[model samples]
Target: MQRVLMAAGISEDVVSQRPSNRQHRLVNKTLRRLEKLHEACADPRLGLKSSSPYLLELLPETASALRRVWEPYRGLGAFTGPAPGEDEAVFLGLHARTLLAQTDRALLLFKEAKEKMFDETSSYRKDLTKLSLLFSHMLWELKAIFPGDRYHGNTYNLTKTEARDFWKMTFGNKCLVRWSIFAEKLRCVHPFQEGLESVALKATLDLTCNDHVSVFEFDIFTRLFQPWGSLLRNWTQLAVTHPGYMAFLTYDQALSRLGRHPRKPGSYIFRLSCTRMGQWAIGHVTSEGDIVQTILENTPLYLALLQGHSQGRYLYPDGQDANPDLSALHRPDHKAKVKVTQEQYELYGKVGSSFRLCKICTQEEKDTRIEPCGHLVCRRCLDSWLQKSAGHTCPYCRCDVEDTEPVEVEPYQPKHKQEKESDTDDDHEDIELVVKQMASLRKKAPERKTAQQ
Candidate 1:
């Protein structure tokens, strides 16, 4: 049995040995410190506090202390050593590192913004408020990234694609656009830093597709520089030489050309281009410390330059007028609303009536409808179904449904009774009172008769 357990990767000796008291104490101390830091960072009052300078100083010190507490347990082996607390210690260390990095990045941005603020800027307070909000947003992102022990190890080394998807899903498109602009600012401000451009470009492209070289295969070049160059090159070369690559490139080029056509006005391509232009404008204004003039004057010129750079010819041939009847193109269609058929209404009613009783328990009280599908289901029946099968579909129609708020239906009551019940309630109470009094008197009489006998 011991040999079998050893073969299964569990050593009895290692399992039997306990972590040292000193290691346990250290782990506990580190956890307490982390908990306190997390609570402080999560506190809403941190943002609302009047002393910004104090917070700026205190946060870094707290981050440094957290780093110091977790330094010794950074990569302690859990299985090989008698350190039972190693796993927890490592997880806490990674979480601390993530939080510390985020705090440092936010602080850098805050300090930069503060330096940019001048006496001429009347909206300094507003700018400071925006910076504070941005810092809070960064903290919120840290919470999401390091949700718990499960993600602590993996979040730090996420692939570019995974990071992009995570950002888009968590922060949304607007925030993603802002992040792109912010990354560009970071790249420009620290141009001398190694690999900053590549990192920024990768991040931007992950969020928004690159239009200029969207057709080319750049993965081959990236893989060629890696340690396993020969093997990767052979693999990537085969992919690049595949017949489908040419077909895909041709399709991509055709689509790109179509998108640039002036008359066609590709809405998606236009929106992407506009987003890029907006990012550029934001970076320019923020860095230059002249927001209004740059927006009013330079933005239009930049847009005009983009128009001039387009491959599509806006001019028509010979005697054709430029201002053709564009009104016809812009005309809005007034479509009438479609009404549901009587048959469909009757079907819905039948479905609703079937749920008057609980399907699982056969009780009469349950009457709730599933959302979007409008299929009726008893709450108890649904709960039982979820527990047994965990299925997310309407039982009657087998249509996919989400676990949303159930719409409850009141049990049918007679209209005449409902109206009269309110009036008769007081009378009913009085009659009940009289009956109770009579019953009490009868009981007393019986007792008195027994006493006389």
Candidate 2:
């Protein structure tokens, strides 16, 4: 694992050197000091006024350690240096650190805000609001750094405009303030609602946070310190004299499998598949459905280029032209006329219609498909029969079916497009109404208090 890390371009010197017993003792002492400080802060009687002299002294030391760990590879230049081979590993390490730091900082701020909110001080509300703003800024920074829905593990990356629109949908137009107000009001109504609101708020704050901190920390550590150590270990192992000293380490990493092309589908090629003396053959399909093989290259290049040309033929490695047989290329025409039965013809006729209502459901419903027996059934009806029946056969045909997977269909769109969709407009209006209702309820609360007096 250490050798793998080094080969992947992580520095060996940093990871290979084990800490001395004295250093371990120092770490233990520091941990004990931190634990004492934590206990002092946890005392409820001291509240926010809890202070530890040791904490004040230890913070500077912690910061110094952090700087030592991160300062060398803090910027883009760390990965863009002269060594092209190590660029990818360096970039991965840098990105991992950035993500770690951002998540940790956000979590710390969240914890601090939660603590401050329990205080009876008048400034707590204002401080909480400021924390909310800071959270929003952090969210924005995260989005900017890792732009697009693809980064969020979506199907594809979004354009700059789409990203802006996504940001608007998530946190735009005082959404945080509105959610906070709603949550506060809901607290008076139900405990479940309050819990739900708190969960939602926390989820919104850390959108893509994962519980794999240890894995990332280990990877970062390995990447930072294994390269030089690996070299030293390799040299020492090789230096040990023996009668049959066979060097086990071999350079076999150059071989790569560039996976199959989408057009060619299943056929794959490897980098080491090409031979220096092999001949390249080009197969062309003739008008009469015959393939003609011709020698494209006799003295071929050692490296294989798996990319396809404009004519849709992939450049592949071929064997030597030994005993060339043109008779193998002759293909007999086996085209047969497909005769549709009366029932199948009727089913085809039904499918050709503009609309076919599901016979099993209401007349207004159009979710219908023609079965093998030329009968139309709704998906729901078909699903019910498939579930309840032991045979799992088609409802109309009663044919012994092996599988009941639904056929893929193009998405249905209405012929007449709407001038303006009401759903989004209605949603916006509903939000406005809710905000107004909340404002009125707040006003009435004060009036009700006055009346009771």
**Top-TM-score candidate index:** 1
Q: Which 10 residues in a row give candidate 2 its minimum summed lDDT? A: 247-256
**Candidate 1 local lDDT, 66-154, one digit each (tens):** 44444443445332332323323332323333344444444444356554432213354344334333333323333333344122322
User: Which runs of model 2 end up more than 4 angstroms from their true locations?
Assistant: 1-118, 140-453
lDDT of candidates 1 onward, in order:
0.32, 0.30
Off by over 4 Å in 1: 1-127, 145-453
TM-scores of all predicted structures: 0.22, 0.18
**Candidate 1 has which clashing residue pairs, if any?**
none
The clash count of every prediction, one per candidate, is 0, 8
lDDT of 2 by residue, 1-453 (tens): 354334333454322223323323333444344344344434464243211112233334343343343333333423222221232223223333433444344345435656554453435433422332322332332333324411221222222122223334542321111234333433442232346446643332222232111111211111211111131121122112111111111112111111112232222121111111012323322334333333322111111122232233323222111212212111112111112233322432433422233434434332322222223345577666667988656554566432221121222233424432322211011223334545777788899999999
